[model samples]
Target: MSFNSPLRDEELISKQVFERMVDIVGTSHIVANRREIMSMTEVLNRSAIKYDVPFRIATSGSMGEGFRFEESDMDVMEYPDGFQVIWDHSQNQHKSFSEGEIFVFDGSHSPPGYGLLQILSPEELNSSKLLFVKYGNSYLSSTFWKKTFLNPILGSRIHGPCISSNLECLDFDYAECLISRCWPPMASTFLSRCQLWPNPQTLQDIVNKECHLVPIGHKLGNHEEEEWMISFSLAEKALVYSMNHSQFLLYGLMKLFLKEIINKGLDEEEEILCSYHIKTAIFWTLQQGSSLECCQRNFLKCFWVCFELVTKWVYEGVCPNFFIPENNMFLTKCHGSAQRKLFCRLNAIYDVGPTCILNWLSMQDRSPSLYSYLRGNTNDLYIKELYNELAVFALPRYLNFQTCVRMLKSIVKSAPSNRDGISALVARMTYVSMLQHVAFQLMSLKKEDYTRDNNFDELSCLAIMQTAKLGSVSDLILRAMYSYRVKKYPEALFILKMAKVWLKQPYMIHFGYLDTEYSSEIAACPGNSLLEVVIKSFVFSIKLENPIFYIDELFTEQEHSRKNHWSTIFIPPFVLLLMLEFLCYRHVDTQRAQHALDELFDLMHSNQDSYLTSVFQDISWQILGICQEMAGNLQIALYAYMKSLVEPIVNRIRSATLQRIQSVKRRMCRI
Candidate 1:
């Protein structure tokens, strides 16, 4: 029994004989379900016709339960113009396979085009040229050509030819013809032209269409006993491209798709799709624990570019139909083109690396020392002026204050500079200050009326409190101005408390290393630090229903008697000031056994501190004015206080004011 079976001879025939059959029929007569594969087969058939290779198309099917296709047993006629297919039949078969003219017409097919092929020598095909491998075909090898050509195009293209299916069997010369022509033939070319319709607009579309979601079978004829067998491998390498349950691969492909979209310019709808895919890719990458640096970098780049483009559109007054409130101002007409122009000018700034931008805006610029960037030259006042200047543009949008606050804070944190630095900065903002000279300009825009908006008042108060931490002269001035604006006595008294804190605690004063921690003997004593006075003022301004508790831990642990007499003087004056200020404000509920002023008056007249008497008198007069609500009398009280503003021996009569004695005289006269 020869291994060279008669079935093999009947299967392939010769490439020359196949061409003669096709030449007789012409290209249009033979029908193929797929035009591209048909076109490819026709071209090979034409070549076979020219070369005189014997070939035949095999008509095959299993009549019983067993049905399979063999590689070498089946063949189809080939021609230079088109295929003249012939059918093959087995004599020993118990069951009948279909017998008819193998060239069955299908209505769907493309018009013919020129056919061409160039056969390579065995060395050429084995060398750099790619191979065309059929699973059941022994002649062909699984070489580069196979992967680059056969598998993607012809192997995937041909559907399993069923018993009654229009495409019933393989054309043997199809493989040989494809292999002989187009060395390193492009699989993409055949696959591309085989497309259903309209063609794939993008690479993603191509993958979506050609790659199968499930396993499919292929056909080749068996030589021995003229039978066919279906071959299944334990695992298929091509299954990677198949529709498997491996979601990870799909996700990877999606990311790859998004990367393609981002690199290639896309239209608006495409851009939106791109964003969705990119977002999903990000989530998938994270879920899969992929730490690819290239993936992250590309994602960031894509995100940043999209963000910038969207922002630019808004700036150009073409708001994308999306909910992006952050860009509302950019779309507003208040600044008109000015705002858009500004964005254009600042595009370079926005192009900064993500980390650098975040760090800079968040006041975390620790590199290059934040100070060096903020500190202007002896004459450079750009940053200082920025707060005031931006205040104007920001006010209309209700963002001025926040903008100013951020700018000033960042600038101050960026460098250590002083109140003069602050002043110079204001000089650059002369126009802005003029624009916002009155607080009502902005306050009028408050959602609540000024009187009804206690929250705003509280925020304003908080702003003042925080300003004391900055400790600039402008901050001090701003604090005073805000106090007058609110007309809340406790709010003003709180400033005195803050000022006391400023005098006693460590605080940064200037932009560069210009922090001050004032704790000399002057700051140590209650009188020297003026904490006693501030406390007294606070106590008088606030009407506490419960006895107010003081923190003992706040005071230094030094013995009282060991300190100076003037330090001791602070206790008496502070107590007297508290009682007198309260009496002035009508906050005191009762007269105690020991009058605060009298006790302090006795101490002052003892000459322990002569200046204390005059100070008491000034405080007394202030009490009188507060009680009377007399503007002129308040002036007189202010004069008295000013008179005793001396470094040492600051003095006057006892704590009783002339106004108090005069009030008694009036009552007595009435009696």
Candidate 2:
């Protein structure tokens, strides 16, 4: 019992205690089955779709990065797939056309005064629901009018000259639609304008891959069209994805500290900082040369370092966006009073030291009790029971399920205070259970007796039953699959159509209340549920191939408003439109084929944010060029081919366009 005893050595005691702490946290905190997490995520997507929640729920934040601890809240980002916000130019002050107003156009004039507008008689307008406008003394064909003027906005028609449709509108709603369609120039010019941090190349690649310019304005009173929030959630996820194991664990530890220790005492009225702010701090810290080795070598030191950075940001009331430094993530939310309170709390925590924190954590009911139980060498029966329960499902082949259960138990123990975290945990649990059920069903089947197809069918049915019980997206897809398998084409088509409607509702909700505070909460459904439904519908329709069935009505205008008075239609996914066009061509229905192509072109024109407009713009033009050539309009076809080669040249496309040009030239020579 001398003062120089080995147990009393300061360095030895510190190492022993901290090392045990690290082991306890690491064993319980780290994501063990990333594959299972991913698979379950996919299952969650299917479930979310089935429920018609428009937001595509994805694992994000610390939980996504795999460093999440028992007390760490889950971060899920909802990407709006079907919902798009276009710049509404008409709302920026524009002239409205009066009934019987006639305007002369030279075909080169910008909208409002540029394009030829023929005022249709009230009767004609009422009966046809079409703008029976004559351009340049010739009644413009419906195709030309649709291609040139009809810009669809949230199931409303925005019509005017193609160049300035937003400038003049017959209806207020139409004007808004027209203005929304004008893609913000800032989005395209973001790389050049904003001084992004770290590597511009890496930032640019992220922007190209997933960055979206949201209509949310940074500053209040700014024109909605002028203000677009450059979202970097995708970029941040990519950065998180690139983190090494140790670095991720450090992030997880920080998140746990924030969620449990920091935010715990804050009142509901308080402007509390979230896990995202902590993540932003970690991102900046890593950018400043904090490495995985630094984290591993000095875990607690790294934790304190991250905590210090977060405190500094909270004190300053300015947490900068990782990609765009100009974007202060905390600018709107973090107030002076809150900042001061947060700074004080952090400083107090720093002054108290690690031992105080450990003591404080141990006192909390929600803190991991397993560590304490182990340390006290008590609760032998309880620990044994827990181990036995886990051991029962701890099959090596089904390790993922066990990992999921461990994660779920940790999540449950954490007792998440937020709705999103709880929802995510529930979703994760549902997915794991569904997966296990399917796995069990498949395992029960004799591999030698059943073919692969039969095994697949049985597994699918099991999955369907599990998902269907929840009454979610996967259920609809499975039901459609069953219908298709049984050759119930029309029934399959109907079910798929219903699924598309469900997929689109979230976007519709978001679109309806663009000005509301909860707009951010309403996200378009992400994932390929709608696309999958469309493809399946197309397959079934093609198999049926009955013109009398009016398959075109279901396929072409699924999102069209049912009310006869409303002429507005949502722009259907171009993939469906493209497939329909191909089907029309296959069936030798030239009129419908031309109509489909025109609609596709109109859609491309109206939706600048559509993936079709960006990546597939050239392909769309090429298809249009070919269609025009077939229609014996060589000049129009040539113009389209040239347009396809216009900026953002794809090499293969250039070569193909040149070949088309030469062929057109040969045809011109023969003519």
Runs in model 1 deviating more than 4 A are 1-456, 460-576, 580-595, 610-662
Q: Assess candidate 1 and give its lDDT.
A: 0.28
Candidate 1 worst ten-residue window by lDDT: 540-549
lDDT, each prediction:
0.28, 0.44
lDDT of 1 at 647: 24
Model 1, residue 668: C-alpha shift (Å): 1.8
Q: How far out, in Å, is residue 307 in model 2?
A: 2.0
Report residue 228 deviation for candidate 1 (angstroms). 99
Best by TM-score: 2
Q: List TM-scores for all candidates, in order.
A: 0.18, 0.37
Model 2 Cα lDDT, one tens digit per residue, 445-557: 45685675565656655654554344443245445544444445556556656755653443222111222232233222234332232222211111111111123223222
